[model samples]
Structure formats: C-alpha cells, structure tokens
Target: MWRDHLTQIIVFAVLFLGVSALGFFASRWRRTGSLDHLDEWGLGGRRFGGWITWFLLGGDIYTAYTFVAVPALLFAAGAMGFYAVPYTVIVYPLVMFALVRLWSVSYRHGLVTPADFVRTRYKSPTLALLVAITGIVATMPYIALQLVGIEAALKTMGLVGASGFGRHLPIMIAFAIIAAYTYSSGLRAPALIAFVKDGLIYLVIIVAVIYLPYKLGGWGHIFDAAQAKFEASPAPNDGILLNANNQLNYITLALGSALALFLYPHTATGILAGRDRNVIKRNMAALPAYSLVLGLIALLGYAAIAAHTTPVLKDNNTIVPALFDGVFPAWFAGVAFAAIGIGALVPAAIMSIAAANLFTRNIYVEFFARDASAARQAKVSKLTSLLVKFGALLFVVLINPQFSIDLQLIGGVIILQTLPSVGIGLYTRWFHRGALIAGWAAGMGAGLWMLYLVPNPATDHAHFGGSAIALSKLGLDTPKTLYVGFLAVALNLIVSTVLTLVLRAANVRDDGDDTSPEDYVADRSTERSSLAAVASESSGVAASRAAS
Candidate 1:
C-alpha cells in the first residue's frame, strides 16, 4: 500500500458519506403518497418528469463499469474497445422507437417489470418467469462489476486494508451504505443521488480530457503511443484501428449491445419511471450526449498509454484509477475516485430495484399471494432488493473478477434472447407464446455453446474467455469473429419467425394475448377516455389514477 495516499482516501470517504446522506434524504424527494407500494418504492411512483428521467436513465446506463472497463478495453486491445462508443450512440434512437411503446403499454396495464409486461401481453406465467429469472441472473454480475469498479479505485488509492478480510472491508462498507439507503429510499434514492453522481462524473472526465492531454503531449502523441504499443504486441489484430479480423467483432458487438442495452430491466425501470411518453422521447433524443462523453472517456486508455501509467497488478480495469492517480493532484484524484464510487451506487440501486420488481410483480405477487396488497408487494420487493445486493456482494467477494466479467458477456447474450417476447412484442403479437419460448431457448443455448467454444487472447487464450467467437468455429474458414449476442439473436429471430409460421399452420391454440392494440399506444388520459369501462372492470383503474 502507498502509505502517502491518505489524502485521496479521505476525500473519497467524505464524498461517499455525503452522498449516503443525500440518498437517505431522497426518500422524501418527490413523494406523492405513501412509499408502501411497488409503484412508489420500486418505480418512484412513475412520476419523474423529463430532467429526473434523464439523470436516472443516464446514471443507469453510463455506469462505473463504463468508466473503468471501456477505457480498460482500449488500454488492453486497442480500437476494438471503441465499440462501446457506437453502441451507446445507436441505442437512443432505438429507445425512442421501442421503449415509448413499452412505456405506454406498461402504464396502461400496471406493469412494473419487463416480465410484468410479458405476463400481461402473452398471458403466460411461464414465459414471464423465464424473463424474470433471466433478468435476475443477468443483473447479478452487472452489480458485481460496480463493486469491482469501487474496489479497483480503492486499490489504486491504497485504501485497501493490510491483509485478509480487512483488505476487502472498505468496499463492503461503502456498498453497505448503498444497500441501506437503497432499502429505505428505493428507486428515489438513485433518482435523486443521480444528480450529484453525474455532476462529479462529468467534472472529472471533462477535466481529465482537457488537462491530461495538454499535460501529456497532445492527442496525436497519445494515439501514436497507443498505436505503437499495440503494434509491438504479438497479435496482428492489435492496433489503433480495426483490422479485417477484429472488424467483425467490433461491428457485431456494437449492434448487439445497442439492441440489448434498453432490454436490461434497469433501463426499463428508468424509462417506466418517466411520468409520460413525452419525457421518455425527449430524454431518448438527448441521452446520446452521454455517448459523446463516452467516446472521450474511452480515449483515457490512450492517455494512460501516453503518460506511461502502469496498472496496479497489471489489472487493466484498474488502469483508469491509476491514470487519475498519476496525472491529477491528490485531492482531485480523490474526487475522481469518488465520482466512480458514487457512480457505482446509482446503477447498482437501480439494477437491484429492477430485479426485485421482476420477482415481486411477476413471481411473488403473481404466484405466492394473488391478493397481495400494494404495500406487501413493496415490502417483499424491498427485502428482495436487500437480498439481491447481498448476493451481488458475495459474487464479487467470493469469486474471481474475470469470471464475473465473463458472466456479464453471457448476460448480454442471455438478456438479448428476450427481444422477441419483450422488444418485438411491443409492435406485434403475431408470435405465439410457444414459439416465443422456443426462440428464447434456442437463442440461449446457441449463445452459451458459442461462448463455451470461443477462445480469447485475453484469458490465457482459453474458451469462454470473451464474447467473440471466430467464424472458423462455425465453418466459415476465416479468422473473423462475431459477437455471440448478434449471432444468437439472429438465430432467435429466425426460429421465432419459422416456428410462428409453423404453429399458425397447425391451427393449435396457444396462450392468448390479453393486451389490445390501443394498450400498446395509449397514455393514461387517452386510456381512460377510450377504454374506461374495460380498464375499470380490470385492475388498471388503480394504475390509471396513480398515473394522473
């Protein structure tokens, strides 16, 4: 440990505690009614306006993992890491088209989770269960990545304890504060703290991009250094620009990631919390600005290359922290670390809330207690949120970080399988429930099989080492590799389309859709005016009143 780094630790601790206080107080922020319901606790009562929605969604998408891992990838592999930039850029317009429809349908039908939407749309609990379980499984490693980001920064600051459990104790304490405030304040905690979290992130990044390049030489020298380092490496594909071999992974990864981003339950939770469709549309149009920041952030890897800053333990993910520690003054470096630490909290809270809502609405309340009150659903969801955070904590503490990273790749593929049931179901219900389930299974199986077979240069060149699988593995006789999610999702769509045609021709009745066409497009007022009698007879009146 660098004993001289106490100043950074102190600054980090101060900002961390300050944000915890803000989170505790956020329980009272924007409160409309009792915080005893899923709508109130899990989704901020679905009442956030445009700006709150923007910060919440931004905080959820541009996470600490983005800060640490994207640059780390660029630091390690070169231009292929820049795929994150394009993925984030393309995701918003897609969001404008798809999620607004999802929001409309969810608001009209009292849906809290994507699984809730699936259950209501396809009228199949089994499919909903699959979606919920997929969400929970996919999210655990994501939350662990946040903890990994915090630990990386702490390790860089020499705040890591002497040895044993003490070494891990600092991060656990920080996450404990996050878990406590999240339990009390729920989604509102993250929504409120997002303001401070994003402010610090932007400040740190803006200062780094402007100051670091000036201090180190210039952008040209930085890129020259990065290109030289990658050129000296053994892999032919490593460089400042994508080559024939890596271009496939780069393009497919970008497209697959864009398709999968908003499909995550946390993103849905953020969007669903928006008070109206207009809020989501406006935020979607504006949120691509974060992608612009992301491109700048990814360049920090080259910045590190130019500065000659070495990663602690040669761990690539720690390079960003090490970069800050090397370049910035001690106090400001601490502030940068705080930015990343607090960045972890916002998304971690949102993700846990999302996973818990999936269980509470689609699993617990749907199965265990059909008559559960809103308060009870919220109660279960809160407790489940605690359990989910605890599970993620254990995941990072007990397991290797590389395994968690691999699972995150798998998570992308896993969540992408639900595109047919959730993303496409928004536009058309032509898909039979049976076909949708089969498509999900086919997609999941293909993705896992491909992952198990693919080897990566990063992971001792072993199978399941990364998300990219070579075309040769699939009989293409080439070195080009494709992102597993892009291929799996393609196969999923084909299976879904073919089976859909087959099932329809068989004249076999499957689980029927319960949602109407207007349900997919109506707001609260329009829903009430058009389908007032139907909504009143159903369970939607309560949601309609809350919407108003």
Candidate 2:
C-alpha cells in the first residue's frame, strides 16, 4: 500500500510546491516598489486584465471542493450534487449587476475591504465590523473545505488512514505550503498560481468526461446504469430531478449561494483588483466558462454510478478519486491527484489574503493603532494571512476533515447576512442604516437558529441538518420545504424593512454622510475626472496597463 501511494505523494508534493513557488514569485510579476499600500497587497494592485481575471476567478470559484465534494455528494445522495452548476450559472449576472457600482464606489473611496464599503455606505463602523467579522468567519471554513478536498483525494490514493492524526497529516502539510507562500507574497501569488490550477482542472475534467465514458461502455450505457441504480434504490428521496422538498432546497441553495458567492471577502478581493469597469465586465461575461466545465463535471456522478465504483472509505466522498483510480493507469491517477491537490492552493491563498485585508483595514487600523504606517500594516496583514491559513489547518486536523464541508454550508449562511448591507446598499439608500443593522442582526440570528436546528445524520448534529427543511418541524401542511438559508434571509429582510419604516417615522438618526445620492448612478462620463484622480493615486500607469 505504501509503495502504491508513494508515486502520488511525490507527484502531489512536486506540483503543489511548484505552484507555491509561482505564487511567491508572482509578487514580482506585477511588481511595485512599495508593497505598503492595500492596493498592492489586497487587490493585486487592482490591475488584473481580462485573461488573468478569468483564470483567477475560475480558480477562485471552482475549487478542489467542487472537484471532489460535488461528485461525492452525487455518488452518495444522487441529484443533490448538481446544485453547484446552477448556482455558478446564475452567479455571474448577479455579480455583473452590482460589481461595477462596487468597483466605482470602492475606487472613489480607496476601500480595501467590503467592511470599508459597509463602513462608508452605512457610515457605521460597528455595522461594518459585524460584516467584516462575518466575512472572516465564513471564509475560514471555506479554506478548510479545500483541505477536505485534498484529504478525499489522498484517502482514495491510499496515502492515509480513516482516523487519528494520520488522516490529518496530508491536510496539515498542504496547509503549511499554502500558508508559507501566502505569507510571503499576499494576493499576487494566488492570482499567478490560478493559471496552473484552472488549466489542470480543465484538462482532467474534459478527459475524464470523454475518456471515462468510453472506458465504462458508452454515454448511453452510463446513463442506463445510473438510472437503473437510482430506480432500484429503496429510498424515495433518490434521483436527479429533486422532489418537491429537494427542489426548494436546490433552488434556494443555488440562489442563496449565488448571492453569497461574491459577498465572501475573497471574491471582493478579486473584483476590486480589476483595473477598470471594462475588465470587470469582460471577466464577468467570460467567467461562465468555468460553469460549463462544472456542468460537465457534475455528470461524472452518473459516470461513477455506471462504473459501479464503490467508495473506498467509509464515506462516499471517495467517488471521484475511486472512479479515476478504476479507469486510469496509476501514474495518470497521480496526475489527477495533482490537479485536486494544487487546486486547493489558489483559493486558500486568496482567502488568506482577503481575511488579512479585513483585519488590517478594519481592526488593526480602526482600533489597535490608527496611526500605523502602511509598511507596518502590510507586515501585520502578511502575518495574519499565515495565521488564518494555520487556523484553518488546525480546524481540519483537530476537528474532523469532513466538518469543513459542513462548516462551508454554515459559512454560506453567515455570508448571506452581508447581502442587505453590501448587495442591497449598492442600489439604494432607502434602507435606514440603523434599520439595516437591525436587519442584519435579525437575519444572522435566525439563520444560525435554523442552521442549528438542522441535523446531519452522519454526525448526528442538528440545525444545518441536510439542505431540506422538515415540514414536520414547522407543523404546516405544504409540499414546499424550503432551504433554511433562504427562509432565514427572508426573515431578515422583512424585519429590516419593517424596522426601517418605524425608524423613519420616529425621525431616528441615519448615516447619510459617507456617500452622496448621485454617486450610485455616476457613469464613466460624469465620474471620469474624479475616477482618474483615484486611479492615479499610486502605481497608476502600471496598474492601468496590466488591467488594460
């Protein structure tokens, strides 16, 4: 067994290390003498052009978790796995609608974090602090989920055992490499490494879809086999088309996930890093290519069923790894494993940077030391990035590796709370800042309660139980069982809206100080002179060319 897995270990270490080196050196790819400013470290100098953004966002959004967990869910539960595809498909248009405004506003104000936007938008540091804290909390588990993907891949290759520190060793080592380069290079490293991450993932998935089917008999046979297996299952809750309950879960999770996607701090890091509105638009338009790949990858679940591949471990998370093992030569499986392993690095690096930015801009500067220098702030952020990665590593290694997947679900709920502040604030000042705060608190409270009530069968925990809402708990006669996150967010919005009217009627104070009413509608023509000044603040020409 040791000899069988040794080749994979060596390949993964080499590919992963090479990717880390690329990330560390990426700091030089778009070098500026002063890495002191948030522009340089936080947004990769806000200058990635269309091609780089596509690869970076592709690597950012479609992660190792997508590669390993989605298929595993499909193999284990059936149709629920494809939720990722629709969510990715719908996310771009949603991002396109709000991102330009966010960029213009952020550019105008020199906002480094989403909390900076919230702080300025609402004119309330407390509210912005909540949003910042939520982002960091939500993102931590997401970084860990990438590690879970690596763990699943390693387990399939027989590199580790099911329990104890042995199972965690691989994740710890991966996290160490991730933490090291991220500490040294900041956001540029991940942006540079994304090219390799996306290229490998694309090659592996494309080849798997075409090659696996031929090896497993044809497309028709694969479909037939999958249908037969699902049909023969004793559970009524099986198959691709969600029943009334799963359908609601599917739609809500997708929509809620789409809304939450860009709200995550790392996503904000990517969008703000773009050179201009055009780069943002072009990237948004082009990013669905990853979604196309995601749709193809989701079909691999059906392929797994056709191959009659049994998951090697106690859990079915090994479906994709096992499928590759069954069909590919061992050496090729090593290459596939490299794809999954390196895929974790890009997002992990980005998330670490985003979290560090939040701490540097919001907490360190705001409270700890208002007079801190930019160079000192950069040093603090760099260290914080390493700590964030290290914390995520501890979560995976100490808790259970599987918990990261569950925690990621919870992260979605936590991140969704930021939408009314970040997403809704983009188009309107109608929401009273105080009322918005009230709304966020209510939404976050309810979302957590609902998530807490749902229980996972595998772990016997309640609250975020499976995606389905048990109608039995609600005590109503309805076929529509909704996603907990959707319901919680709805509750949050209602409470916030009602409170806004009351606050307005009482003539309570609102922070209309930070942004002007006309600022939201300012296009390139009206805003050009002001925009040019903000763009020229530092490293303007190099930033412009890279973005161009």
Candidate 3:
C-alpha cells in the first residue's frame, strides 16, 4: 500500500513544503517598518483589506477539521453531522453584529486579545485572567484537532505507522515546521498562506463534488446507498434523515456551536487583523461563500458511502481521504490530501498566535510587567506561540482522538461562558464584573460535569463521551438529547442576571469602564486619537513609577 501511494506522497510533500516556504517569506509580504511591535507581529499590522480579510477569515474558520472531521462525523452518524452546515450559516449574522463592535473597540483601545477588552471593560485583572486562561485552554484542543486532520491525511498516504513512535514522528515534524514559520512571521504567516490553502481546498472540493457523484451513478444512488447501510446497521438512530430522538440535539448543537465559534480567540485574531470595521462587515457578507462550499463538502460523506471505500485505519477521519483514494486518480488523491494537510496550517498558526497574544497581553502585561513596551510584549508573544503549538502536539500524541474531539466540544462550552462578559458587555455594562465572573464559573462547572456523565459505548469511556446529553440525564424522562453547551449557557445567563440585580441593590461598586459609548462606533480613521491618548497615558504611568 505504501509503495502504491508513492505518487500521492510526492505530491503532498511538494505542496506542503511550498507553503512552508511561503510562510517563512510572508514577513516581507507587507514590508513593515518594524516586526517588533505587538500589533505588527501579532495582528498583521491590522491592515488586511477586503479580499485579504475574506481569504484569511475563510481559512481561519473553515479548517482542516471541516475538510476531515465534519465529513468523518457525517460518515459515521448521518444527518447529525450536518450540524456544522447550519452552525456556519447561523454564525455570520451573529458576528456581523457582535464582531464589528468588537473590532471598533479593539482598534480604538489598541487591544490585542479578547481578554484585553474584558480587562478594560470590567477593569478587573482577575476577570481578564479568567478569560485569557479559558481561551488558551479552549484553543489547545482545537489546535490538536487540526493536527488530527493532518494525521488522518498522513495515515491515508501510509506515511505513518499504526502505533508507537512512528505514528507521532511525522506529526511532530509537521508541527515543528508550522511552529518555526509562525514564530518568525506570526499572523502574517497564516494570512499569506491562507490564500494557497483556501485555493487548493476550493479546487479539490469543486472537483470532488462534481466528479464523484457522476462517477458513482448520481446523488440519488449516493443517498440510497447511505440509507441502505444505515438500515442494515443495528444502531437505533443511524439513518440519513433526522428523527425525533436527534431533532433537539441538531437544533441546540447548531445554535450552541454558532454562538461559540467566534468566541474562540483564533476567530477574534482573524477578525482583529482586518484593516477596519468595514473590512469586517464586508468580510462577514462575503465569507459565507465558504459556507456554500462547506455544504457541498458535507455531501462527500454520502459519496464515501456510495463508493464503498473502507476506511484505512478503522477511523472515520480516514473516510474522506479513503474516498478520494478510491474514486480519484493517484495524483488527484494526492492533491486532496495536500489540501487537507495545508488546511491545518492556516488555523493552527492563527490559533497559536491568538493564544500567545492572550498570554502576553492579559497575563504577562497585566500581572508581571505592567510597564512592558510593545517590543518586549512582541518577544514574549513570539516565544509563547511556539510553546502553544508544542502543547497542542502533546495533546494529539497523548490523548485519544475521540477524547480530543470531546475536549474540543467542551472547549466550545467553556468559551461560550465568556459571551456574557465579552460579547454582551460590548453593548451594556449592566452586568457587574463580579457577576460575569460568577456566571463563567457556573457555566464552565456545569458544562464539565455534564460532559463527564455522558458515556460513549464505542470507546468504552464512562465520562466525556460526547457533546450530546440525554434529556433524561437532566431529569426529563424523554429519550431526546440536547447540546450540553446550550444548557450550560442558559444556566450562565440565569446566574448573571440574578447576581447583577443583587449587586446593584446592595450598592456594590462595579469597576468603572474605560470605554465610552462612542468608542464602540469608532472607525479606523477616528481610532488613532484614542490609541494615541492611551499610549501617552501608559508612557506617563511608566515614567511616574520609574521616578518613584
């Protein structure tokens, strides 16, 4: 099998190496005066135009997981996997309202991470630390998910062994290349490489969607084959259509995931890289084109079933790669695998940069070095990105892939806890800082406990089985299942609301906000004055401390 796939391996290597070279050279793409500044190194100098922003955000959002795991889930479960499609669709309008405001305020205040905004909004270092830590923890498994995508591709090409050191050596090597480029180029690396990654993915998906259906008879036969397989299986809920048992899970999962998607630090990293609020608004309108591509890609799960392509490693993630290998020519299969591999790089780089930015801005700057300069912050951020990527590598090497998936689901749950503080706090300061912190704690605790009780029989794991919880598990007798994140966030809202009222009535002091109402509406052209003012204040404070 390895010898037969020599052509595919060659093609994958050429494309992968080509992108790594591009990533190294990306530092010079925009030709900044200084790469030492945190804004330049961590955010591509915040100058991405409409088209660049479109491709960068598209690449950041539609990841290798979209290419591999979504289809894998579809292949294994049927209609339930299509939740990603609706989730992507639901996320755009929501972010259109939410992120534009976040961009304006971040640009105005020169904030580098969501936690930076949280700190300024609440004037609470502890709350910001919580937000920053949650972001870093949530993002680690997500980065591991990307590595899982590349591992699936490598496994499909027979480049890695079934177990032991051989299995992880190739993954580590790939991560090392990513870590090097990201350390050098930071956000620019991913923004530049996204063009190639998105282009290859578009080409591969276009060909697969058009050619595979015709080759396998038609879409009709594809669905027919999927239904036949599900019917023959012993599983109770395995058909191509949604049943009453899964209806609530489908709706709640889509809603919860959509709410949590942009809350990830990587998504905010991409959004903050835009040149202005209009760049964000335009990208929001245009970025949905990738969702259209995603809808078509989801059909490949059915295509895999129609082709009767047995997964290579008994892993569902291998289903898509195996489908390409079975249906397409060797060279084209190689292209598909390369697309999946390179797709991992864009999001991995962004996620690491985002996590590093959170650590540098929120933890380091806020706690250790309140007087740290931009150059020093950038240095810390660069080193932190390398550490974050290696942490993700350890996650992939040490944990079961299914467990990583569950951890990512819990990540979404954890990240959603921040919406009350970061997302809603953008518009209103009514929720006290103490209330927001308590709310986050409630949501995170409930989410973890719920995930711990759900069991996966296939893996024989008694805890952290999956994101879906039976309604019966929550004291209802029905067999229906719902997303754990949604239920957790509901409890989060209740706690925050009740606490906000109690705090207000007790005359508790909420930290005064640093931002004004006008800041949320500020555009790039109007933001410089505020940025300059903040910089002057920070310098003065540093000098005063030095004099003392």
- The models' CA-based lDDT, in order, is 0.87, 0.80, 0.88
Which is the better candidate, 1 or 3, if ranked by TM-score? 3
| Model 1 Cα lDDT, one tens digit per residue, 114-179 | 999899888899899999998998898788888888878888987665358866676687568878
Taking all chains together, the TM-score of candidate 3 against the true structure is 0.95
Candidate No. with top TM-score: 3
Clashes of 1: 0
Pairs in steric clash, model 1: none
- The TM-score obtained by model 2 is 0.92
lDDT score, residue 74, model 2? 71
RMSD for all candidates, in order, please.
4.7, 5.2, 5.3
Order of models, best lDDT first: 3, 1, 2
Q: Enumerate residue pairs that collide in model 2.
A: 46-273, 451-463, 451-464, 452-463, 453-463, 454-462, 454-463, 454-465, 455-462, 455-465
Candidate 3, superposed: residue stretches over 4 Å from native: 403-407, 527-548
Worst 10 residues of 3 by lDDT: 398-407
